[model samples]
Target: MDTKTFGQTRLLKACAACSVVAALLGCAAPAAQYYPDEEQAIEDEVGAALPPGSAIVEFTTNSAAVAAFQQRVGDKLCEPDAQHIAARVRRREIPSEVQQNFRGLANFLSLGALAQIEKLPKTKIAHYPANQPIAFAATAYITDGTCGPLFLQFTPQAAKRYSLSMDFNGQSCRLGIREMDESTQTRPVKHSRWRCAEGFLGIGKPTLIGPDEIN
Candidate 1:
């Protein structure tokens, strides 16, 4: 299929998944905060128990690639009861034409900023269970109330560090997860994006085949 077609298809799938997730996760109201840093910390104290020797996985970003770039989105864990960020801006107060014309000004003067959103971070680290199904979700809230959400499930390898990032560029938003090769410096370390085929919560139709991603 062509690039546009592929993008549209992916976006459709993501939106479908996003709706199901929104219903299950109570996404009707967006959280004032961005990342679930405190939530994750609480999880460590009382969530799930990881197998011995579980490795680490870090998100290159806890929030959207651009602050408020994804206008409104749910939490990243892909689990129920996760928080959502509602990049609150009185867009009604400012004309759309003006917003398009003065992007930085609009961002700086948002009600969310008054809550000290400037203190938000772009990265998050977590302890992941190895060789087990782990679910994750990301939604890119585009302008004009359009949002794309993708839910994926994969497993991490023991003793390996994984890095994951999500980006949205118009047609499609991609969630790229890669294992950071821990090879000695004698050989250059490499990190290649892996694929997650499983649908965490009735999301994708499973067009993928392979457990290779678990490693």
Candidate 2:
């Protein structure tokens, strides 16, 4: 073969080898790692556990409604009952069947269905502010009216323990690095607190508490 043709052939061979090497390298490299911070990782875990693209809703409220809600649901481990009531009130119109079920369940002495809800990995709560809007985690269904501020309770399925520092209605809900129970109940930690902005709730999904968080 002519010298010029031989050189061209060698160049083509070299280019082909380079292409093969590039393809192999690309395949070997890991996919994009999120490399999220502690809180972000927790949130990502929670988001993954939730239904695809779950919708979060916020409600408006007033003092009277808040007071009534507080009165109806006290701090006696009645998270389930409180959620049921809040769901109905925030929506301003729950199905008769749902209301009947909740009230009927309430009448019974079965921890008022608190255990039932606690057992589940996922739960939602609504907070209603009279004359404002009701806070819903998923969607809104208001029949009577819409006016003030509300909060929703979201019990994560995979998060055993998590902390939250959220700003709702210009107020802060702060907690430290919380623990998750085997049943996936999230509660606050005493020390290890941090200032988080609004809409930041750390959920503890099945994640190896990284070395940084540990140390």
Candidate 3:
């Protein structure tokens, strides 16, 4: 073949080869991951363990009432009674302080659910490894109407122990976390202890909450 014809032929072959590779790459591309019915998944895996009708409640600044309720609940706080306790708070049978703790715990679980719904970071924070920190901006239904520009941190203390901290509504509290026993009927997802503090709760879990949950 003449030089120009040969060059044209080579060019056409190269273009065809490029097209084939592009097609193969498109075929090899990963399928999008979808978690359909996530809410149901949460209800099944986590919510089922909670007391029936358990949900995120609002937080308030009534320390005396909260403290009193804390004393009343005492060890029951760590038990499966969380849902029952939360129900009392919802019914206004208990003071807001108790609800505040339950709300925080609910929000914490909601944050975990949110993490699964989105992509949240798993990083090392303090002495805890693979901690998750939810930023103020990302705060949503998980906060349960708490004031924003707030940060929520969750750090695993042990096998089932975790810690949560947040400052909202003029009060600061660090919650000592406990996960419900999966084998038990109570099946509470978490139990927490509240200690009052002065300012913003320090960053307990350094893992950042961001697009990592999605990616």
Per-candidate RMSD vs. true structure?
12.5, 27.3, 26.0
Off by over 4 Å in 2: 1-141, 147-179, 189-215
TM for every model, in the order presented, reads 0.43, 0.16, 0.18
RMSD of 1: 12.5
Candidate 1: clashing pairs of residues: none
Candidate 1 lDDT (Cα, 0 to 1)? 0.40
lDDT of 1 at 105: 46
lDDT of 2: 0.25
Which of the numbered candidates is closest to the native, going by highest lDDT? 1
lDDT by residue (tens digit), candidate 3, 1-215: 11000000001123333344334323233432222222111111232243332322222211111210111222221221232111101001221333334443443544444223222211111222223321111111112122222222232323232212221112332221223343632212222222122334653433322321110
Residue-level lDDT of model 2, residues 1-215, one tens digit each, is: 11000000001222333344234323233332321232121112233343332322212221111111212243222121353332212111122333345544442433333233222211222222322222122111111122212222332222233322221121211111234565867454322111112332545332221111111
Q: Predictions ranked by lDDT, top down?
A: 1, 2, 3
Whole-model lDDT, model 3: 0.23
CA lDDT of each candidate? 0.40, 0.25, 0.23
lDDT string, candidate 1, 44-148, tens digits: 221355447686665543333232212112323323344443222111111233324544443444533322433334444457567765555455443323333
Positional deviation of 12 in candidate 1, in angstroms?
14
Clashes of 2: 28
* TM-score, predicted candidate 1 vs. hidden true structure: 0.43
